[model samples]
Target chain A: MEIYELTVHELLEKLDKKEITKEEILASYQNRINEKEKDVQAFVTITEQEAKEEIKQKANNPSKLAGIPIGIKDNICTKGVKTTCASKMLENFVAPYDATVMEKINEAGMVSFGKLNMDEFAMGGSTEHSYFKKTKNPWNLNKVPGGSSGGSAAAVAAGMVPWALGSDTGGSIRQPASFCGIVGLKPTYGLVSRFGLVAFASSLDQIGTLTKDVKDSALLLNVIAGHDEKDSTSADREKEDYTKALKNDVKGLKIGVPKEYFGDGINTEVKEAIEKVIEKYRQLGATVEECSLDVADYALATYYIIACAEASSNLGRFDGIRYGYRTKNYENLKDIYRNSRSEGFGAEVKRRIILGTYVLSSGYYDAYYKKAQQVRTLVKNEYAKNFAKYDVILTPTASNVAFDIGSKINDPLEMYLADLCTVPVNIAGLPGISVPCGLNSEGMPIGFQLIGKPFAESTILNAAYTYEQNTDFRKNKPEFKN
Target chain B: MQVSKEEILHIAKLANLNLKEEEVDTYMGHLEEILNFANIVNKAPIDGLEETIGVNEAYNVFRKDEIIESLNRDELLQNAPEAQEGMFKIPKVIN
Candidate 1:
């Protein structure tokens, strides 16, 4: 049997039935990586030997994901492993400790196959910002997979791994998952610990999972979620088995469809596909209601400002005097810091840092930065109010399917617009998931998003899984099977 | 809709970036478009409502202040680009 075609549950069943050993599964994936990695380029670093050893040890564990191979985004720190965030700034830097989520993953007995590629420091919507190499979409080799979490999404879509852990800030996880035709979930802000996940925008950042199906996403979330002493933002709440809520019943569930989402700029094909998905949900004992978000158009703008502001502060520690890249020849202290940052950071990162700094500067603080925060309250409140009436909000994961690589590199604002629908969820601190709905005329995958109330991920997963079961879109696999 | 080169340089210095002259025009164009688009936020009706900086409304996230041992010299210096005599060494600041 093709190992990549099996769901996480099916693979576990095979192992329980003595059909395969952890070593055999690891070997099969390693062989697949060797055969397909040259074309896919989904991973930044592959820890083949480490993966085999981990799986062998985990073979004795009782966890469901004990022997499953999962990919991790480069931004999440793994102790003694290089976590570069696909940027040149930390190319040689090795983390001294694993992020809280990574620690939990290890405890759960999941084998991390490798660190996947991503946009440099999760800045751009397209993976082209990566200083290492561009990650091609598994579906269409010439097209992009999606940004920030593009590599994680593409790897799962390409069958390189059954699941991957990705950080979502401003729709990074959901948008890429939509493009790659997989299920990606961005849990509520404090649902997952971010202690060791390299901070992008601390307030908006969340660790989520990308899987071939919704069940795997829920299972992975169940394993890596909960409060940790390391992260102050982690909520002190009880953990629930998210898988228990995936019965695919949406009776009397209120689904909101924002009017602004269906407006201009959305491709006709994507709109049609989403409409069909909505129709299916309606047919399956649910109600779809048309709602309006007053600040929908401003989501990208507010997201950029607030995210960059937080990033500028979070990245301040990476000076030459501290950890990360440093210039070899520096005459003075100022030169060391300046030259190190100039030589270390990429163009996109530098651009945002400059923008963030300017906005937070004394003169512009009141005009731009503070104003954005004040408005952010409105956006969050809007979601809070809407959640009172609806169980979830449904929208297209992206305005369009994956575009060709480098298409929006020159147009940064246009690229930022790609996360328009997904950013609002981040701003509101709500959980959102993207599930593959259909393929456009170009045969590229299109994802539909489900936004749920705070910590209401199970509702969203159940809805998406129910719709997925009713649809035939996920049956076709990419032609590049190893 | 256009941002001046002087403004760009000013923001850059504040943001701790040493940008090349050629990059200013690119940032200028992008920032202008973004700020113009951001005007939409001004129209949002959020006058009396309290501003939300974080999600879930769980507040009072203060930690108890207490003395804790700092990182050892070696561990601290491990992250430095250049350290000497158990401290970070840098070039002279004053002329």
Candidate 2:
């Protein structure tokens, strides 16, 4: 196998044995990027110079991620690197300092290969909302690689990078990973620091990983998951070596299959694929049973209100004052703020901001924003009730496989439904992972998610790893050759 | 649930945005649909439920009030669209 195609674990073995050098692996990935990037358009900026510098100044006492090349989602701040959140507002914005996650990754010796693409400010489910370019699914160029981590998933699926970082607000990472046929994990909300992540919905957003398989997800998580003093929301708990969780055993594990996720809107093929996963788990000695989360039906409504409200507040800082794009013909300070934002933001972003402002506006706060917060509590309580009984909850990562570009972009409500299954996990601030389950007749991948209790990433990782090891799903890679 | 163009314009003003004349109609439709969908939250059985302000139980992450070195002013101003003497320059507010 090509060095670029190897998982982080496999590459590390080769590196330790002196069978391959960091330069060779970097070159192999660079070659893959050259071969496939035109077709995929998975990155906003490819940091080849930085990667080369990293390989040259290799650390003597190498960490597990030492010399490994990984793509960072555009929203994560990397000092001196262009950290555009796929938005024109910050097209020229170079981060002044590394985010907490970037600091951790740098300390672990991981090379920042590039800045992956996403929805503008991590807003949309399909990368079509990006101000730059749309990232096509590597599985089929005609389809989307789900967003706002679409570029991260596409890059990993296309073998352009071994693994990449993705941020999830409302199903961004796992949904795209499901569409692209890879492993994506949205860690527990407080599991990873969000100090440098450009805030979408501060309460719901999290930094995660998209990789070839479950073990790679665990490997990356081990490096990035920990409490940081910089982010107040970070959990002040003991950290675990997530790599040790890859035991590939699910015997006696209690898994709850949420029925709400399998309701009418889910595609038949996707439903059958998840059924197969449930059957496989049952066969592997797990106690699988149907469960109901009544509050899940309210997830979409709650998510939109809360996410938009927070987004509106978080994004208020980008008013052409401190940094980012500025309007040239502005006559006054208000004009500068108004015109710069109106011109810099894309349509979806604008829609969200307006919706958020409307929800939080006088006379409407109680009906929308406050109501959503109360519903959010019920959703959390429901998950907590289930987690008390089950080790993990299983569901399809998305309602269906990726749709054609422009198919649902015009229909905002339809686009929001794409996150029906995955959004509930984020709402509860739980760790969830999407692993490729099977392929549809159309040849697109179907994925099933395993969501664990808060800070119980190890449980879901074990379940996902067991399923991946027993099945040949991990062996299936998108045929990107054209 | 129908958001009028006037309301959209008002919301845009609140959001510090100046929507184009053409974009306003499209936004009105989009916002109406989103709000209609978001209205479902009102139907949720959330009686007596406390609002979840945040998922994390962590509160008041405190540290000693010690001074830490900050980012270099010159380096920080590198990405500013308009910078003057290590300060971000903006349009005049007081005329």
TM-score of each prediction: 0.96, 0.98
Please tell me which predicted candidate would have the highest TM-score against the true structure: 2
Give one digit per residue, the lDDT tens place, for model 2 in A153-224: 999999999999999998999999999999999999999999999999999999999999999999899888
Q: What value does DockQ give for candidate 1?
A: 0.59
Q: What is the DockQ of each candidate?
A: 0.59, 0.84
Candidate 2 regions exceeding 4 Å error are A59-61
lDDT of each: 0.85, 0.90
Name the weakest run of 10 consecutive residues (lDDT summed) in model 2 chain B: B86-95
Give candidate 1 regions above 4 Å deviation. Answer: A480-482, B62-79, B85-87, B92-95
What is the interface root-mean-square deviation of candidate 1?
A: 2.0
lDDT of 1 by residue, A171-254 (tens): 999999998888999999999999888989999999999988988888899998898867888888998999899997887889
